[model samples]
Target: MNQTIQRRLYKLYSSSSRSSFGLRNRISSLGWIVVCGLPLCAFMASMYPRDTFFQLLGVVSAVCIAAFVSVLLRKAQLKVRRLLPRHASVGRPLEYTVEYTNLAKRGLNNFYMLDLAPDPTPSMDVFLHATEPGEEKRNAFDRFFLAYRWNWLKSRFLLMKSKLFLANSVGGEKCGKVRVELLPLRRGVIHLQNMRVVLPDALGLFQRVKRVDQEEDILIVLPKRYRMDSFDFAGQARSQVGGDSSTSTQGQSGEFVSLREYRPGDPPKHIHWPSWGRTGKPILKEYEEMFFPRYGLVLDTAVRAEQEEVFEELVSVAATLTSEMDTDQSLIDVMFIQQGAKVQTVGKNVERVEAMLELLASVEIDPVADWAALKNAVLKHADDLTTCFLVFGDWDDERENFLQSLSSFGISLVVLVVQDEENPVKLNSDYTEITLLNVGEIEQGLASIHL
Candidate 1:
């Protein structure tokens, strides 16, 4: 992951390009509009002096000449190289570098530089303005002397540096880490397949644009944080303080469950020779696997807050737990809170949960989701499972009722709730619950839970 990110940044820093036709056309159109229309418009206005037309023409001509000169000076290939951090996490700062040279023959004066960036998605069309060059000193502020000429005969090169941070926009405030990268502009199609721009127009008009072309782009991606605690899962397991389905016996002895006639496919170690001899046939022994009685995962898409991050963490936890239990003959299942489908009786390498993660990552939040209907669906499904791992946040009356219904079904429930700052969950119930702050804790937390 680190190598892949570093290579992309390196490529951007080493790349360069000459001015495009689009830039030339826009600048020319603006200059011509003022140069050709100003004198005519001033002549029509009765309030101005009769000689104003001449003065306007001279002023417009000089401005047009300056515009043409600036365009000639601005034609150059800009090479940008940014340095980004490895092992990227949520709410962490990333660093990058920007480098470019003035490829024109003469010094480009009074011009600002802007790099195009990518859009964050859906209906919000916005691009990152990586760096902005400050305006040069106005020519009017210069001091001139007799017999002295300005040294404007030779072309010059330019070097500028800049930085930008990556963050999440919540309640109109940006939060999270500063991310950076360096990539060299090259010959290939640098597809910022998802690019957009929200910027001021030539006349200071605010315009939002989504770019869909073969060129011009920016590099910025959202982050995922690394955490090491699992309060929800652990709390769920400990909730059963004194029950018949408590912790397994400490001894290594396997508990007996039943016996059956042995077939050719039965393992040799599991064969009960004595019992087989009495019946003149082979018999096999079976043991009930010691495990948490019920483990259920509930995915509440109704909680639209930070939906993407929540989805990632939920999927990571489910996948890790499923993989661990599979190795030890433990059963697991995942239930979607809103979606009717549930991943039940999950075996090794269950594909349903994997599919769920991808779906979750892409799903956008609908601010007006129907929580009542979602709760009803969960209540109906909770009746059939013996042990379930439920993943969710704070509950209302409907969720509380569904949880209470599990008690009658003899189900042992373990809940893994994703943590939030202002909405902390209380350890108020006997049912085991674990709170996961971020995806980083999934592996370590599973290692500590035996059943």
Candidate 2:
């Protein structure tokens, strides 16, 4: 997230490109057409001094100046309030309503509202490490200058069509609602900084933007979920010892089911004294096994810079699996490594599936991450997990050994290696429950997979 050479280049390109687009949007379609030809007219007039191009250029420039001035003088007093949803998804278009209360004495016309947000530029670390798809095949200048990479990373944060039409007219001291749609380019939270009310001139040559309000709002953009109609966790209860006991009201007494005639060697604590008193013979309280089947969703983070796309695909797959799992029937422990080992559980007695997805949305790739971190995390709860799904960025000896060790722990293994079609990854050995999912064809592979 620092300002490295790569990050600087990215920031430079992002700023220039956004500025160009903002200027283009500020100018109306007619104004842009004239402006585009104005430079050509100037060039022609320079080449042929007595040409009519000079007069045309002068007239267009004068009109643009007057229009710009007209917009600058006209001001709109408006307060903006936004109604945003709690969450959004990457690549999905989401709509929200914005209320504009006009504070001016007269009605305003031909204006729109634009949401302001912090620059969605990638951090220095991200800019330097993550390679844009087909980046190597680009021209020498583009590859060296990182123009392709810059735009690709920046696009991840941009809210498409941030500009929304307010209304043709809004009366003084009145409120108007405008439905605005924005496409999220990336997962994680988008920090909306402020709102702007754009006032255009009669000719619509330029726009005067007024800062209506400064309010920080956030939209949690969930990861892209590759819908899987069927995915089997292949989970089995690890232990029947405490099945539903922990969730019961009288947890210390286990999950009570019924009472039976007391048998030899029955614990006195299990004896139903009231029933015993009524029947003259002792009775014991019976309890059902309480443990829910728990499975591990392991997300491997040891990814290289060139495999950023693979990491993203991996996260999306993990997120999709999390969404598809029936948490009510089983427990899922999402395991990954950050600075250290981390694990989050979601199920009947744990957090919700949404919480797990939200956590996955924030997962980032660590090129130097140690496999031991994930192994340690998984082993910590291995005794309770029935099966483990290892979503790996790449397949190597380390990951293979990790699986073998899990086998020693008697955990069923399902290895899913996420890679690009251009550069496919191979499993080190012939193993059961291993699925190779290409970047673009993950869903097909998922569907065809039996377990």
Candidate 3:
């Protein structure tokens, strides 16, 4: 009962805040009409008391009323369609075109259109609660006056009130296009709700809004990627048939398999001299494929409620490594526990990078995911992986034991532990691949990895 009441209270507050913002904007738009029109009409009537001026005032008032009524009655028969990309990167500006077609017989004049965008960033209330008590207390007043609460409220209202006027006239039975640019401040899914058209009176004193619902376009904003030149892991390459021979080829550089007719781009070194001399034709030597490095990226999704920010940093690190690694030359396997333990494999030839990023964009902390299940998932792929990159939020004993167990499998392991400034770096003498990185200085820590 208490939870229900609290929820109701929150909903009420949110609705009231949004309504207040809309009211403020509406007043600002028509404030001059009320402030000047009423007094001028009264003053004119008082001074002229009879014919000319009073009659002129009545005529002006009637015209204003007729214009307001016409605007209110005007029906905009518009078809709105949006063209947007499938994905966006964080901190990058994305531009999409919105096409509006006037299907009515009469043309639309002096009208504005706006695309409704939903905010995906965390709310101010969540941010305040995430901060320490001292910090929260220090900024309590600012939070009340200068926080995103009002901004979100205003934005929510403007989605219904504000719009972009068509610079050029949209004739009847014609189509017009407008481009909208949005800069995503964070990583998440942004839902494009609808397009709103506002038709205002001749004097621009009153606006009539029409909302045209479109198929919701969901844009996944990927996490920011960092530059990583290379990642080196300590392990012996496994030999496999039909595998890349760049890293694990044994004997005289490569094992020659067969000779084939030389192609235009065939290197001179690969040309079989004996075959060319015997057959009197250009021949190229084919070698057995070498082993390609396969790396496992284990993301620790088990985070405490308060340590959500740490998980975000861990995700960014994972995304950066995933982007920088040569998927074409090597295979990357991403392992994380969502509902259950799951693994996604990506390679140079595959177009799964966007899928992987989409998964990462919506990943949330799941405390219920057992550590044993996560361990088993990684172990299942141990034989195929040449090296494994483990991104963890905390370096607890359980996690250390998990890494130790992975190291026992002889697969090279690189562990990146995200910690706060207060937590001193803990050196692990048992493993050579462990690197401690403060959440504030991830780039420096990643750059310091020598092996």
Ten-residue stretch with the least lDDT total in model 2 = 245-254
Candidate 3: segments with Cα more than 4 A from true spot: 1-8, 24-75, 119-167, 204-206, 229-287, 348-351, 420-433, 438-445, 448-450
Better of 1 and 2 by lDDT: 2
TM-scores of all models?
0.37, 0.81, 0.70
> Can you give the lDDT of residue 72 in candidate 3?
74
- lDDT score, candidate 1, position 96: 43
> What are the per-model numbers of colliding residue pairs?
47, 3, 4
Q: Once model 3 is optimally superposed onto the true structure by TM-score, how far is the C-alpha of residue 326 displaced, in angstroms?
A: 1.3
Query: Considering every candidate listed, which one attains the maximal lDDT?
Result: 2
Cα lDDT tens digits for candidate 2, 118-163: 6666776777887787877888788778877777877765654365
Better of 1 and 3 by lDDT: 3
Ranking by lDDT, best first? 2, 3, 1
Off by over 4 Å in 1: 1-117, 120-191, 194-226, 229-295, 304-332, 338-347, 352-356, 364-387, 416-451
Task: Report the error of model 2 at residue 192, Å.
Answer: 0.7
Residue 256 displacement in candidate 1 (angstroms): 20
